[model samples]
Target chain A: MELEFVDIRVERDYFLIQGAGIFAPGIHLVSGRVGSGKTTLAMIAAGLKTPDSGRVKRHGIGSVMLSMQFPEQHLTGSTLESEIASWHLQPCPVLALAGLPGREKDDPFSLSRGELKRLHLACILSRRFDLLILDEPFSALDCREKMATADRIGSIRAGITLIFTHENQHLPRVDYLWEIRESALEFLGSVPDALVGWKNKPSVLADLHKRGVYPKNLSTADILEAACRTHD
Target chain B: MQDARLRLLTVIILSVASFMSVAGALAAFIWWIIFTPGIRTIAKSPFALFFLGFTASVSAVIWLTGGDGISYLVRMAVILLLAFYAYTDRAPGDFLDLSVWLFGKKIGFDIGLAAEMSLQGMEVLSDEARRTRVAFRLKAIKFGFRSIAPSAGLMIYSQFARAEEQADLLAVRGYRGGGMVCPQFTRVKGDVIASTSAILPLIFAIMPVGDIFILLQ
Candidate 1:
C-alpha cells in the first residue's frame, strides 16, 4: 500500500510540520529532534489525526494500526485475556505469540513494563494492516524479544511500516529514511545507502553505539555479526 | 445466574450500599434542617431523603421479589439503618480507599506495581521529550508559528528527566510487575475473629430485614 500527501501541515503549540509526503512501500525509518512533528506526521498519515491543509490520500487495501508508546493506555479491558481478544474480530493468540503463556489468566496491569510492551506489540503484529505504525516501540524489551520483533517485521515487510524512533535502532529491512528537521521531514535516501549520514549522527546515538561496542551499521544483524566475529 | 459466592458478595456489597444510601440521606436531611433551617442547601438536601426513601423502597421490593413481605422489608430496612448507625462514625473516604488499597493488594495488582506500570509509559514520553530538547538545544533555532512544538519539547524534556530517574529508582527494587506475586491470603486469627465477632452483626444487619431465617430470631 502507498500513501501520498500533496502538502500537509500539522500545527502544534511548540512545533509545526509542513509539506510531508511518503511514496514508499517498506519501512520508512523516521527520526527527528523532539517536537519535529514526526509522530504527528505518522498519525496524520495513518488517519488517526487530520492535517490542517493539504490532502492525505491512501491507495491501499487492508488496515492501519497505530501501536502507541504505552501499553497500559491501550489496555481497555480490565483483564488480560479480554484485552487481547478485544483487539480482533476473533480470538487472538497474542498471549502465546508474545511468549506469555500462563499470563493470559493474569492481569495485564500486573505484567512488567517489558512484558506489557511485548504483549502490545504482539497484538499489533498479529493482525495485518496496510500500514503498521509503531512509535518508539523498542523501549522496554529484552535483546531477545527485540530481535524477535525485528525479525518478524523483516519477514512481513509486505505492508507499509512507519517506525518512529530516536535511537539509531536498526531499521527492519527498511526502504527509505525521513528525518524530522525543524518540524519538517528531510529525506535521507534508503537505509544502507544512508550509512554516510549515520556517521555524522549526534553523539547521543553514537555514544550509545560506542558503548554498545558494535559495528557502525544500522541493522541488528550487522551488529550481531560484527560482535560474533570479534568473539571468534 | 450468579455463582453462589458471587451472589453472596453482591448481596453484601449492595446491602452496604443500600444502608449507606439511607443513612446519607438522613444525615443530609437533618443537616439541612438543623444548620440551614431556612437555607436552600437544607431544602435541596431533601432530594437525598427522597433518593434514600426510594432505595429503602427498593430493598422492600427486593424483599418481596424474593417472596418476603412487609415484616421482612421493615426488618431489613431496620437492620440496614442499624448497621448504618453502628458504622456512622466511620469515614467513608478512608474506608473506601482502604478497600481499594486492600483489594488492589489482595486480588489485583498492588499499589507499587500499578503505579510502576502506569509510570512506565511516561518514561517513553520523557525520553522522547529529552531527545527533542537535546536536539532543540543543539540547533537552537527560533521557528515561528510552531511555538507549540518547543513547549511540548520542553515539557516532555523535563517530565522525562524526572521520570527516567524514577524508573531507574524503581529498577533498584525488584519491580518486574509480577516480581512479588502477593502472598496468598489465608484467613488468620485476626480475619477469623473479625469475620465472626465484628462482621456477623453487620452481615445480619445488611440482610434485607425480613428473611424467615433472620425474622425467626
Candidate 2:
C-alpha cells in the first residue's frame, strides 16, 4: 500500500510533515525527542487526526490499526477472555502467544503494566492489517519482552508498518527511518543509507561506524560480521 | 487548613448557609471574591470557568423565562465557590478519614472508602475523556453525537475494568471492610477562628433580620 502525506501542518506548528510520501511494504521507524510531535505524526499516518492544512492519500489498503500509547485506554474487554475475544479471534492461541496461558477468566485490568502491554501487543500484532501503527511499543516491556516485541513486529507482513519510539538501545530491522527535526518531518531514507544521519543511533552502529565499518543491516550478526571483517 | 476535619466542617457550614438564605449566599459570594485563590487561578482553571459559564447560562435562561434569576445565580455562585474551596487541596482518601472519624471503624470506614474511590473514579473519568478525545482525533473521528456514544461506552467499560483491578489489589493486600486509622487534627489558631466564625453565617440565616434582598428592594 502507498501512503502520501501532502504538506500536513498540526496545531501551533508543533509538527509539519510536508510533501513527503511513504511507499511501504516493510517496517518504517519514526524517532524524535520528547514532545516533538511523534505521536501527532503517527496519528496522521493512521489517518486518525486531520491536519491543519494537508491531505493523506492511501492506496489499496484494506484496514488500518493504530496501537495507542496506553494499553488501558484501548482495553475493549472487562475480563481477560473477553479482551482477547473482542479481537474476533480464538482467545486461547492469542493468550499463549502473549505468554499468558489459562488467564482467560482474569480481569484485564488486574494484570500488571507489563502483562497488560504484552496482552495488548499480542492481540494487536496477531491480527492482519494493511497499515499498522505502534506508538512506544517497547516502553513498559523488559529486555526479553522488548526483544520478543521487536521480533514479533519484524515478522509482520503488513503492507505499511510505522513505529514511533524513543528507544535507541534495541530496535527491530528497520527498512526506512524518519525523524522530526526543528518541527519538520525529515525522511532519512532507507536503513543503511539513513543510519549516517541518525543523530541518536544505537551504540553498536555508532561504534562500528567510528571504526570505519558501516553495516548493511542493524542486526547483531551483520554488525559482528562487519567488525570481524574490519579486524581481518 | 492543616486539619481536613476543620476544612470539611467549614465547607459544610458555609455551603448550608449559602443555600439557606439570600443574605448568607451574598455574604458567602463576597467572601469568596475577596479570599479565594486570586483571579489568576480562576482564569487558569477550565473547571472554574466551566462552572461559572454553566451557572450564568442557567441564570440567563431563568431570567428570560421571567423568574428570580438574580437570587438563584447568587446561591449557585456561592455553592460553586464553596465546592472549589472544599476540593482545592484535598488529599487522597480524605473522605475515608472523615467518615471513619464520624461513624467509627466498620460502617464509617466502608462509607468513607466508597466515597474516596468514587472521587478517584471521577478524576480518572475526566482524564480518560481527554485522552479518548485525542485518540479519536488521531483516528479522524469528529466530536459529534455519533462518535460520542461509542467513546462514552468505551470509557465506562475501562473505568469498570480499572475498578475490578483495584478490588483485586485490595484483596491481595489483605484488606478488610473495617479500616483502622488514627485520626489526627491540627487545630491551629486560624483554623479555630475560622471554624468559630462559620457559626455567624448560620446565625444570619436563622435570625428575624431577614434577607439582604429585601433590604435592597
Candidate 3:
C-alpha cells in the first residue's frame, strides 16, 4: 500500500505548507518543529482536511485512522468499557493492553493524561488499518510507556504507518525519514542514509554521526548498538 | 465599531428594533450592510447552521399555527445576524472595557472580568467542538441524536477542566478581586455615523408604518 501527496499545498495566514512525497508500506517517521504543520500534514494525509491545491492519492489503502495529539479529544465514551467499545474492539483485551484491566467501570476522563494516552493509543493500535497516521503518539506518555508504545509500533508488519512527532527519544524503527523545514516537507531518503541529512536529529544520532558511526535504524536499541560500535 | 460602548449600544438598539416590527427589521438590515462587516462573514460562522435550523423550525411551527411565519422568520433572522456581527467584531477585552467604563472599579471590574473569561471560554468551546466532530469522523461514527449525550458530556467535562485550570492560574498570579484596568476605546468617524444611524431602526419600530410613510412624503 502506498499514499502519495501530489504537490499538496495548505495556505495559512503567515506561511504555506507545500509538499509532494509517496509513503510506501512501512514505518515513515516525520519530524518537525512545533507549529511547523506536522498536524496539518497528518490531517491532510488522513483526508480530514483538504489541501488548497493538489491531491492525496491512496493506492490499495482501504481504511485510514489518525490519532490526534491530545487524547482527550478522542474521548467519546463515559466509561472505559464504552470507550474501547467505541473503537469496535473488545473492552477486556484493550483494557488489559492499556494496563487498566479491571478499571472498565471508571470514567475515561478520570484517567490521568498518561493513562488516557495509553488507552487512546491502545485503541488505535488494536485495529490494523491500511493507513495509520499517529500525530505525537508519545506526548503525554512516560518514558516506560513511550518505549512500550514504540515497540508496539515497530512490531506492525503490514500497511503504511506515518508517525508525525517532535519526539527525540523512544522512536520506533523507521524505514524512511522526512522533515518539514522552512514550511516545506523534504524527503531525506531511507533509514541510516537519511540520518546524515537530518538537521533536527536527536543528540545521540548527532554524536554517533560525529564519531562516523551510523545506526541501522531510529530505534533506541539501534542507537545503543551504534554507540557500542564506537568502542569496537 | 471601534468603540466597544458604541458597538454594544448599536447591537442592543438594532436587536430590539428588528424584533419589534418588519419596518424595523428592514432598517436593521440596511444598518448591517452599511456598518457591520458583511453577511458573508456571519454566514461562515459555525453557529450559522444552528441559527438557520432554529429559524426554519420555528417558522414551520408558526405556519402550522396559522401565524405570520414569514415576518417572524425575517425578524428573527435579522436579530441573529446582528448577534453574529457583534460576536465576530468583538475584541478580547471589549465587553470588560465597556462594563468597567459603565460601572465602578469593584463591581465593574468583576463583571468585565467575567465577560472576558466567558468570551474566551466560548472560543475554546468552539475549537473543542470542531475537534470532536473531526474525531467522530475519524472513528466513522455517525453523529446523530444518540451521539448528543457523549458530545455534551465531553463539552461539560472540558469546560469544568478549563475552569479549574483558570482558577489555578489566577491563584498563582495572586488574583484577589476587583483589579484596576483602564478601559480605552478608539472611535472613528464611521463609529459615530453607525451609532447615530442605529437609532433610526428604534424610531421606525416605535412609530407606526403610516406615520413613517407620511414623514417620508
TM-score of each: 0.48, 0.60, 0.96
Off by over 4 Å in 2: A11-23, A230-232, B1-122, B129-217
Q: Candidate 1 local accuracy as lDDT?
A: 0.56
CAPRI quality of model 1: incorrect
lDDT of 2 by residue, B95-159 (tens): 88888899999999889888889888887887787677655543445578865775676688777
| DockQ agreement of candidate 3 with the native complex | 0.70
What is candidate 2's lDDT per residue for A68-177, written digit by digit as tens? 88787666455778667656668899889889999898876568889999998998888878888899998889988987888788777758888899877667777998
Q: Lowest-scoring 10 consecutive residues by lDDT in candidate 1 chain B? A: B1-10
Off by over 4 Å in 3: A230-232
Runs off by more than 4 Å, candidate 1:
A89-92, A169-171, A198-217, A224-232, B1-217
Model 1's C-alpha root-mean-square deviation from the true structure amounts to 18.2
Which 10-residue window in model 1 chain A sums to the lowest lDDT? A196-205
- The fraction of reference A/B contacts recovered in model 2 reads 0.12
